[model samples]
Target chain A: MTTFFSVAYYTFIENIRKKIFYGLILFGGVMMGASVLLSVLGGQQTLRILLDLGSSAIEFFALLGVGFSAVTLILEEMESKTIYLILTRPVSRFHYLTGRYAGLLMALYAGMLAMALMHVSLLLFNGWVFHARYVLSLFLSAEKILVVGSVALFFSLFSSSAVSSLSFTVFFWILGHFSGEINYLGTQIPSLAGKLAIGIFYYVIPNMQYFNLRDFWDVPQVMGNWVWLSFAYGCAYSAVFILLTVMLFKRKEF
Target chain B: MLRLLVISVVLFSVVNAELARGFAYPLAFSAADAAASYTGLDIASVVMGVRKLGADIAWIQLLQYYGTPEKPLDEDRAFQLSWDMTKYLFGAKIDKEVCFTAGCDDKSHYHPQIDGGVYPLFLQYCYRIVALDPSYYFTYLYGGGALAWNLNRPQEALLLLEHGIAVLAKYQHASVRDIHEPYWQLNLYVSAIVYRKSGDFTGMLSLLETAVGQPDAPNMIKGILANIYQKQKKYTEALRLWINIYDTNDLSYRRRAEEKVNELKKIICINPDFSIA
Candidate 1:
């Protein structure tokens, strides 16, 4: 446990040092500003424009940061033979991988925090500030990020670079956004191939859309039950993905 | 790809056919003629149709908001089309993949929120679309701001404008936000229009004063003061405003100003005292 904490702590620092965190601020910041133009061209749906842009940008940039970092960190350590050195120490491979994953997860959390600040700032600027629910949305967003991070790490067990791992991770992101529709469409399509694709994709993908309570948060119209249900689903999905990542890493050759 | 294209085309045609069949035949020719004379056929007809659809959607959304509606109504077809368009605006990347056409962009500018839905409900829907495509400005600007304002919902309009501005601020940064700063200015103008329609000239003037200085304010707005002055038979002051508009602005509203100038001339023609230096 101590060794895991040490690896996680260092990994968090290393990931933070990269340009990814800055990119998060820059991308999210830019999107918030662009909402003004959206309001203009939007004709009369400005609030919708601002809220949508602010929340969406936060989700996209955070996902990208997590996916890229998870894949790159694991691959780089392996490529540099750093994992071999760590393995020779008293630390077990599970502890090392767990620590690294934990660190990446923390970095993902930091990226989300940076994004949440941007969202809050944008909200304040727009003069539609909400506190309690906004913070909940941020927590949900962070969980969504973890799902992506875990997927990226799982792919990294065999991936050689962040790009390849991200490619797979991107699929998960797409799946997360479209999971509901996929399930809906699965029922409509009669073909075995179509049903199989939809069914398999439904289970395999992260289904991030389930956690997307941005609409609910912005409107604050949804009941507490739905919010709780979404949180439950997100937590369950995150745990499953983390377990999958650990399993893949355990079998990976050093 | 070919199969998908064929399927989409078929679906599109079927949907249009159904819609066409549902239209009131002979089109209430008397009422249609009166409306056409004032607003022109295309704009008039489309607005009336859209307004009706919006009204239905609004009622449904209102019901949904109050928890009165137990089931989604068929009126949601229009809402869903707008929803899909909003989805596309956000980089869903499904526009090309789908066989049927639906979604918002430069072309399909109607925002469901602006049309007729309950304010909060529509806000949630619009937020989803904007989230997907923060760059698509029309959803927030025209849909939320202008339409809602015209519909006599200023509070909702303010909310929409604020959100839209924030999104643009984030993506485009302060510089681009400045470029589109006229939009924020226009919101004030719309407020003036709203007040003017409500017979609150004092409030209108106050809003217009703020609006005219905005980077994007049209010259016509400045001329509006002159027109208002002319209404009061304050021809000389009106003339000065008309001249200011004529001297400073470009051609965008030249014709409208020309008509206003002619109107001012008629006022002076009736009373020699109306002439200004």
Candidate 2:
């Protein structure tokens, strides 16, 4: 476990060295800045626009960072024979994989922190004190990053870096909003098989909506019973994904 | 003389016809001038642009018809200018009709229901705006919180206000400073209203304190604070603030304060040792 953590920590440091992290941070800052300009468009909803742009930008850039870092971390190391040097030592494949996963997770955590700090600084600068829920959102955001990181790590085992990142990220993004749409569609479709297939898929896929407490936090409303259940679901799904990745990495030739 | 007389009649008929068509801008300007003493861009930049275009077109038509600048100001031209200005400000024919309704009763009823059949069409329109830009706190604040809350749809207001705050939080965390402030204020305001309405006085007090300090804090918020204090039997403080409001520049707040003061004074007179007194 110590070895695993050390490896993960280093991997996270390596990801921070990449250009994409800086790029995403810059992009997010610019989007937020643009909100002031958008306010002149005559509607009294400038803050709303700013909030939407800021949140969407942060979510997008964070997801991008996680996907890019997780995708390339293992595959690049493997393709360049860097993994052999690491693995030729007394370290096991499990340690290597776990280390890499931890590192990516850490990088994602750091990125989210930086982004969150920037937003908070803005609020403080504007003389608006922080709300308690904003702190909870940080935890929730981190949880989301964990889920995102797991998907990318799992997909990287058998696939190319580009494919792994794209596939998993797309899957996460689409599936995040899929449950609600699928449930709505369930009533419209006439065939029983169609409904059954959707039902099966629903169970098979992670219900991303479960992690969404944005509705609760925004409105100062309490999260429903399902929010906690969703956390449990996320943990279970992440665990299974990590286990699968470990097994796949252990069986690989190089 | 006969030829001149015939031409005069023809010009008069043309002018009357144009007046009947509603191009009356001079009349609009005169009416607008009478309404207020203040002078600024009260019509908005977009309306100004439309007015310029209409005026230029009317002038060109007047030049062509009269063949000189010496012709009397055409009533038809004035009507055309007013019609063009109204069109520019209001948009299509249907919009003009809707906007022209005396008290918004005709316009408010046209909203369509979604799956649940809960809200009418206009509410959906406001909801769509929030959906398109969840960060826009004003829509949820004024449109959802103020209007919808007054309309007795607290749930919907809460939902919108929640989403709006989430958007603000997301951006705020993302380092978007501009949205972070207003949204924070809006969140405080909405939550305060909800807490007050739900009779959660302590929670409401906390929110109201935050709200009064916000840049977008309404003048009426002071009244809410006073009421809360009054309910807590802090009559001296409430009365002090209420009296200040009566003496303040915000005329809209004065009447409410006066009424509250009168009612409280009457209560004190009726019951010398009343708990509130």
Candidate 3:
């Protein structure tokens, strides 16, 4: 457990030190600040505009950070041949992979939290009354990042190059959000082969709508059980990809 | 690798099935509708999962469109007059504006005198906005109110409000009396418009009064009610409502409210028992 945590800590520290991570966070802050100016355009809906744009900025930038770090963290080590030094130690490959993922999450979550704090302060400054849904939305956004990061990590191992992996990850991200549309199309199309292909894609892709609690923040039907179910789905889906990533890592020559 | 893949697939399938049964994803707008009203930013909003932000952008565009003064129909008039002379001389055919009406009260800001007060594609803009984010209740209220009151097209307003009601039906609570209930509020707006259409000024005033009394009633609605009160010579009531609107600090109504408040104060000072005869 200590070794696991140590690896996670090391990965977190290394990832946070990257210039891209800092740049993304800075950009996120600027975007959140810009939301205040944008809110004026909304007239009477100023508060709603601020809330929507601010939270979106945080989630978007955090997702970018997660995608970048997930593809690069282990691949960079492999390319530099620095992974051997860790593998030669007493640590197992599974621990290394899981620990690195955990660290990536930690770093990204920390950045998200910072942006969220800035958002909350801005909201409060503008007299936004507190709501538990804000916290729920932020938490669900983190879960979404977890699932996407895991998918990216798996692609990093499965694909031949970092560029292809990043591309595939982004493709999946887009597909994931449209999972409902894809499923609906599956039912609409008459061709048997097209239906079969869409059905496979539907089940294979992570359904990001599950973790899109922000979109449903004002929805009255989304009760506590639904939240828990979505949370479990995020964890389960991410675990599936993490397991696949571990399997691929175990087979590598290094 | 085969075992791992099987495990991953099985795990994903199990959780996915459970989630699918427990939670329903919100339905997106139909592709046909989205394409019909597709602005460049709207396509990005749909793909990027920022529908609310996109709705905000569309709302701003809608405001800008409405804020700019409508172009005069001078060219259309010239063409019509020339067409009449041509018909008198040579019997030439000319198309006339089908929806034109005469004697429209140009003095009223809310009443659109030409083309039945319908701005070109105003309803389409409202439809596009609601399609992007149905939960944006303000779009429904603002667009519906403008259509019914300013455009003098109560039918279009009712249509918009009904769409809002249908889309937001799931959000309705068991108690319909709640002021914060978006469904109930929309119904109130619909009823007020219906009363106005039927020429029941008293009924319309009562409904507007009830609506503006709600804690969450928009300042725009309050401004409307205050205007009605002033017209009816209920200076004290109008003054009180204007003060309330002024306190809300809405940019659209604040200056007007301040002017009305001061004007009403002087009227009351001249006659302490001021009332419409």
Local accuracy of candidate 3 as per-residue lDDT tens digits, B1-277 = 4676677678667778888787776546655345337688987876777777788888878875665436554877556554543342232333432111245544322222334334867888888888888777887888778888777788999988998887776445422443247887899999999999999989989988998887667776787787778788998798889889877655545555665777787877966564321
True contacts kept of each: 0.00, 0.00, 0.42
lDDT of 1 by residue, A181-222 (tens): 566788999999999998876665655544555533322123
RMSD (Å) of each candidate, 1 decimal? 19.4, 25.0, 9.3
In order, the B-chain TM-scores come to: 0.35, 0.40, 0.74
lDDT per residue (tens digit) for residues B1-277 in model 1: 2354355445434433342233211111222123112223223222222222222223223223432222444777656654554454443433332221123344434332332334445555444334433333444543343334334566665565676565444434324323345445545645765686678989987776676555334454565566667677788677656666654433323333444566677767766454322
Ranking by TM-score: 3, 2, 1
Tell me the TM-score of each prediction against the true structure. Answer: 0.50, 0.52, 0.86
What is the per-residue lDDT of model 2 for residues B1-277, given as tens digits with 9 covering 90 to 100? 2354355445434433332232111112322123222213223211221222122222222222222223244898556544543343233232222122124555333211111123333344444434322433444555454333334566666665665565556445334345556766766767766876687878978776666555455444566577768788877667656665565433334444665666666655655443321
Model 3 regions lying over 4 Å from their true place: B1-8, B30-36, B72-118, B170-180, B270-277
| Clash totals for all candidate models | 62, 21, 0
Instruction: For each candidate in the order shown, give its overall lDDT on alpha carbons.
Output: 0.56, 0.55, 0.79
lDDT of 2 at B275: 30
Would you give me the overall lDDT of model 2? 0.55
